[model samples]
Target chain A: MKDWEKNIRIVEPYVPGEQPNFPEMIKLNTNENPYPPSPRVQKAKEELSIDILRLYPDPTSNLLVEELANYYGRKKEQVFVGVGSDDVLSVAFLTFLNSKKPILFPDITYSFYSVWADLYRIPYERPAVDENFQINKEDYYKENGGIIFANPNAPTSISVDLEFIEDILEHNQDVIVIVDEAYIDFGGISANSLIDRYENLLVVQTFSKSRSMAGMRIGFAMGNERLIKAMNDVKYSINSYTMNQPSLYLGVEAIKDEDYFRENINKIIFTRENTKNSLEKLGFDVLDSKTNFLFISHSQYKAEDIFAELRENKIFVRHFNLPRISNYLRVTVGTDAEMECFIRSIEEFLLKRA
Target chain B: MKDWEKNIRIVEPYVPGEQPNFPEMIKLNTNENPYPPSPRVQKAKEELSIDILRLYPDPTSNLLVEELANYYGRKKEQVFVGVGSDDVLSVAFLTFLNSKKPILFPDITYSFYSVWADLYRIPYERPAVDENFQINKEDYYKENGGIIFANPNAPTSISVDLEFIEDILEHNQDVIVIVDEAYIDFGGISANSLIDRYENLLVVQTFSKSRSMAGMRIGFAMGNERLIKAMNDVKYSINSYTMNQPSLYLGVEAIKDEDYFRENINKIIFTRENTKNSLEKLGFDVLDSKTNFLFISHSQYKAEDIFAELRENKIFVRHFNLPRISNYLRVTVGTDAEMECFIRSIEEFLLKRA
Candidate 1:
């Protein structure tokens, strides 16, 4: 190795789900929304003049923030925007979690939490979830630098109620608590209602799952003005122009069509319930999912085997090889026809094994 | 103040140039391209399918990286892309400047350099540029953590030759040296030619200025495979999906039309020379600019006064309130008609002062 290479900051990066582009594949990984974005998005794209590409986008993203503020019934100063939910959460970690004490989160939650902690050299500890993959609110009552966890958590698809969140917030009032709501719009209740009550709580959401504009890369956080202002300060010191022009313009249109947004969310919920029933009938123990995905395990087969079989048949699902959850497969709720095809493939695999 | 607020990381953010939206404003404050993007960019936008917005953009941004590699005659592994040059440079600072020693740059260069060092807590020393605003290469020969400077540097619009850069690289072989070439397309020679010879050198450029895609937010870096890989690892850990789908697809079309790129660049250079001659005739001293903007000062009027007068006439130019350069103004070269209007406005202002 070269002498200069000694100073390079290196880390094991988080591996995102595979994005294969097979023409006929049924992709149920990454928790992407099955339906397209609202029709107003198409109109917004059409109205965008090509000539506007010469100027810089509004550094503050005021238009999108105002629309989001209006839609969520919050003050404009309460909203902050980023490239995606990951970006928003990452910036929040840097800006708020600065104490010497170790921060805390559930061990079986979104994996990116630890990655961000490690990247920033912020000491952290993982408080393991209980046996049912539920976040124990009492686990966070201890002193720490900060706290963060995903509600309707990734890979588990289980959500805690508003009362459960308020219980934890009641105990941890001295530190900032981040509730990542990437899956909230599917079925989970948002902590946005409590933003007015708790100045230390920051609730984050994204356009990837429910709004169906992940390709445009938009996410935001809602909190009290002071917390939002601090995050904006760090963000501007890093990169003032995070959201591009098309995203700012089209994201407003995505929020304007409230009926279309509701229609798509309802469709995904309906499909998720039906898929859970089919998998349960097939002898799989499916978790009670409030998000648009199902986590299931079979009594007689390994999750790695099922995941491999599904991929061989051109179907995709997520499986973590970590301890205690190696037997589980997290499948995103796709279109009804896509889920039907996935069920058929699973049946064939189980029959052949028998 | 709240107890939890003590942990929030706060800093004074970098203030970007004004992006005023008046109907008839002559906007020469930010150095954006005066022409629209390539015609092919319009075709690409028209051909894009809105349905693709439902999924996440390719996290690696492979399509744009490959196109940049092909255009620059480098391997794909030697290239990196980000939301814009600011994002790319910010990540580079985090990845490469990790040692205990202080990094080096010019005091009067791009103001964001110091802001980034402060944000990341990296120790840095700014060897002041000489009275002529030229970097003294010998100042960089000492020990340092890393080095970075803008060639055809910001606000001064001056560039050092290729041999001068080669000399600095020879002296700083023990640490990473970054050549920020944001204004290289206007006139300066790029250090990209020296990448094959120096493995420790990283060159960053942006599409916002010359390709007319500031609204789309595209920027990239070229270096040896090792340096590029280190930057990518840090970027992936931060935000895997930095570049959006529309930017990746349309950026390729921007590179394919070399004729339009060169035509616009030549026009800007032509307008810059004529504007310089006109300003000199008005008894204003203009620096020899090798960028899309000109650095100038008037013996009879303060820069703040000129900036205020221009704003009153709806012609915006940039004035920085700092030591040594407080009397200088940075005016971006605009279209022929726009520059004529600007010249007339300045002439009238001078007559009034006389």
Candidate 2:
């Protein structure tokens, strides 16, 4: 290796869920919405002018920010948007978490947090989630530079209550607390309501899950106006045009269709409950998921083996090879028909093995 | 500001040109192409399936990379793509410019470089360009962590030759050298031809100027395999799917329509030469521009006042408020009809002052 290469900041990269491209496969690995995006979003894309591609988009994304602010009953200054939640979190890490003392997060939360901390040379400690995979309020109450974790935490899908979140925020008044609500629309209450109370709280969310626009890459954060200004300082320094023209156009459309948004969110909640019951009937211990996915482990079969068997049967789900979560499979809740096929394949494999 | 806000990193942001939304304005500010994107590109975007919005795009961006490789006669491993040239340069800053010694660049180059250095906390030094607004090769021969400057430099619009670039690369064998070729397609010979000989060279180009896809946001870097791998590591840590699906599909289509790309590029070059002659006839000392824009300063008229007068007449151009170059205006080469309007406005202003 070259000497200059050795000086490059390196980290173990975050691996997203598989994006298999073939047809006829029951794809439920990543937490993507099963329904199509809003009809208004489709119409917006169709009506865009092709000639506008010659000019750069609005760097401020003023229209999208206004729509977001209107939806939440807040002023435009309280909202921040980015290419996606990953981008929002990375910029947050760079801007807000530069203390000498270590930052704090849950040991078993979204895997990208620790990766970012390492990449940016920000020291961080991941306190353990307790026996039930819940973020311990006491674990975060101690002194730290900042605190952040996913609500309805990934791979476990359990969400702590609003009171518990407030308790931690109340104790940590000197530091910033970022609540990642990527899955909050499924069932969990949002910390967005708490932004007015805590000036240090920034609640991050994504349209990739609830709005079915993962391909468009839109996400945002809401907090005190001062905190958003700080984040925008970092964003504008790095890249002026983070969101493109069509993305801004369709993002406003996606936020405007409130009825379509509520109907599909209710549908995902319905399918998630039904799938949890089916996994339990198959002798799998399922977590109490408040998300659009089920985190389950069978009593007898190895999760890795079952993951492979399902793949052989043309189904896909997520299996994290980490220490605590190796035995559990996090399967996204697809449409009712797709999930039925996934359950039938699991039954066939388990019966033949028996 | 709150207590936690004190520790946040801040920097002066880079201000791009105006993107006013009115219909009648003759916009020539941002250096965008004067033509629409290829018809094939419009068709590719139109034919995209809205149903694919439910699934995540390929994080690797294999198809776009493949087409770029084929076009450049390089392997797929030698190319890297990102949202735009700004995003590509920022990732390069994070990946390859981490040495302890101060990086070197021309003082009056693209304004965004210093902003990135400040954002990432990379120590850098800006040696002055010569009196002709040209980069001096000997000035960059001393010890440095890295070297980066735009050929056909921004705001000055003068290009340095390939032999001069080779001289700098010959002197610095240890650190990486980035040759930003944003305006290379206009007239200058590309450093992309020298990548096979110098392992430490990285050339960056964008579709914003020549192919007219600034609104879609596509840019790529060509270099050695190891550098591309390192860039991917940092990119995956920051954001996996920086490029959306439609950009990838349309990027390939833009590459396939080589004839359209050539035709438009030639048209811009022709207009640029014509504009330079006319501005010279009007008593403005226009720089020898090899870009799609002209850098011109009048001997009598103050640029700020002229900028305002043009704005009053529904014409827009860029005038920086920075030191040493405050009297000049960087005007994008628009359609011949638009350029005629811009010339008429300037003549009207100069005659009024006379």
Please report the candidate that would top DockQ against the real structure: 1
Name the top lDDT candidate.
Answer: 1
lDDT of residue B348 for candidate 2? 94
Model 2 chain B is weakest, by summed lDDT over 10 consecutive residues, at B9-18
- Pairs in steric clash, model 2: none
For model 1, the superposed segments whose C-alpha errors exceed 4 Å read none
Relative to the unseen true structure, what is the C-alpha lDDT of residue B347 in candidate 1, on a scale of 0 to 100?
A: 94
lDDT by residue for model 2 (A1-354), tens: 785575566768777667886679888898899998999988988888879888898888999999999999778999999988989999999989988889999989888998899989889999998888977789888889999989989979999888999999999999999999999999999998899999999999998999999988999999999889889889988888989888899899999999999999999999999988998999999999888898999989999999999999789999989988899999999999999999999999889999
lDDT of 1 by residue, A189-302 (tens): 999999999999999999988999889999999999999999999998988888888999999999999999999999999999999999999999999998989999999999
**TM per candidate:** 0.99, 0.99
